[model samples]
Target: MNKKVILSTVLFLSACGGSDSGDGISLNKVKSNDKAKCSNSRLDSCYYDINQLALNIMFRKNDTGVLNVTASVSGPKQDIYFTGSDVLEIHADGEVFLPTNNGADSLRYENIPDNAQIYEFFWYRNSQLVEYNSIDGITEPSVILSTSQHDGSNTITTDWLNNPDYTYQIHTPSLWCTNLNYESEMFSPSTGILDNQRPPYQATLQALYGKNIESLKVNYRSCDISVTLIAKNNQVNYRNKQKRLFIHHDNFSEHPLTLFESN
Candidate 1:
């Protein structure tokens, strides 16, 4: 299916078959990141901050087990919506002010459910749907993450375990990082293009359905082995000068169990 269709399917699947709470969730203190550099008035900064805000709420829900979350985010983009069962609205002008290259834009979420398994964010540019982020596999209370620019181009599936230092093995076009006391690890290269010659960290990854995937299935370590679908991208290798896919093995050692998926 196409990327748009895949995104729509992801949203539909996330919204279906989940326990709902009667108490709604809310978000407060929404502020855009003014400290960011934006050629187009801080697209990356604005987008990143808002996205981070949503993720922060998700993690908070996991930790506290609160049924509703009320938080706010500020960034460059305006007319943004955080969609799940209900919508978290964004307002362009708010009470707070920040020192940004662009003007301050604020948003807030009222009564967000702690049991919300999926989150989809829609961002607009010139009244057009420029980008959207779909977060799924959040049923478990462990850390949650969707794909980001930092992941380069690989589709990824991540797991966080209570016990650490476990050796993991998966098929190629796949890599596992272990041998440390990290509670979280991510595995990839599951049903996508594989470029063996390139280093794992430098490779550009893609999703199975489309390039620049906005939807992902998140899971905890239910089994010893799991598979993830890598998305598409055009990152090249400097040494070989060829387009390739690589493996990523990140063991978040030296840090306690905190979610690093937002960066």
Candidate 2:
């Protein structure tokens, strides 16, 4: 299966999901950092603020969880995401972890630490080296995830303890044909016949079928893990979230708890 189908994306341009109700969460103001250095903005040593930084951890059904953290900086390619070798440091309980960075825009940390209740996503940004952060924790569904596919549709069942108090978000891919709807419409007969050249009915049907033509013969291609997040409401007021992390919860983890099989 192609691993790139359902790439996880969170917020950046603004806030969403809900307001910052501290509840069990905590946050720090984007404050001054003594280590910040920006003698000049045009130099490689200067660090710029990122569009977003996200840390996502998914607790699996039968094994350890997966961690994925990314920091996105919007600017010319000459500028780097971070100023130093240290990509990100996560503080959980009394221990600190530096997620592995293979020189990509994101970091990968495997197997969330046991006994971890609170997490501080820590990363660097700006010429002043102002610290960016968010306080988020892993929320396991009350009941494990189970999915069944029938007739190209998906049915997901989960127990969220008190289902009324929480909601679930399913991140999955649909038939690729659905995504190419606009392109398929271009081939429709109504699009108008060319100069002295009318489109044939069989040819038009073939063009409209496109990718699904293969699915008709070989079924469908398997997709990425269909991840789910279970969340509840909180009344506490935490520091307003920053570009550091934008998702109430990310779409997936490195591990698969549930999937949408090919039809």
Global lDDT scores for all candidate models: 0.28, 0.34
lDDT of 2 by residue, 39-96 (tens): 3333222333233323332223222343443443334454443434224455555445
TM-score of 1: 0.23
Clashes of 1: 34
Ten residues in a row with the worst lDDT in model 2? 193-202
Question: In candidate 1, what are the lDDT values of residues 1-263, reduced to their tens digit?
Answer: 10111222222112233322211212222234333222323333343433343322222233455422232333334433332111222111211111111222223333344333344343333222223333332232333243222332243344333222222222233322232343444455535433222212222234322323222223322112223222211221111111111111112111112112321
TM-scores for all candidates?
A: 0.23, 0.42
Top candidate, metric TM-score: 2
What is the Cα-based lDDT of residue 141 in candidate 1? Answer: 31
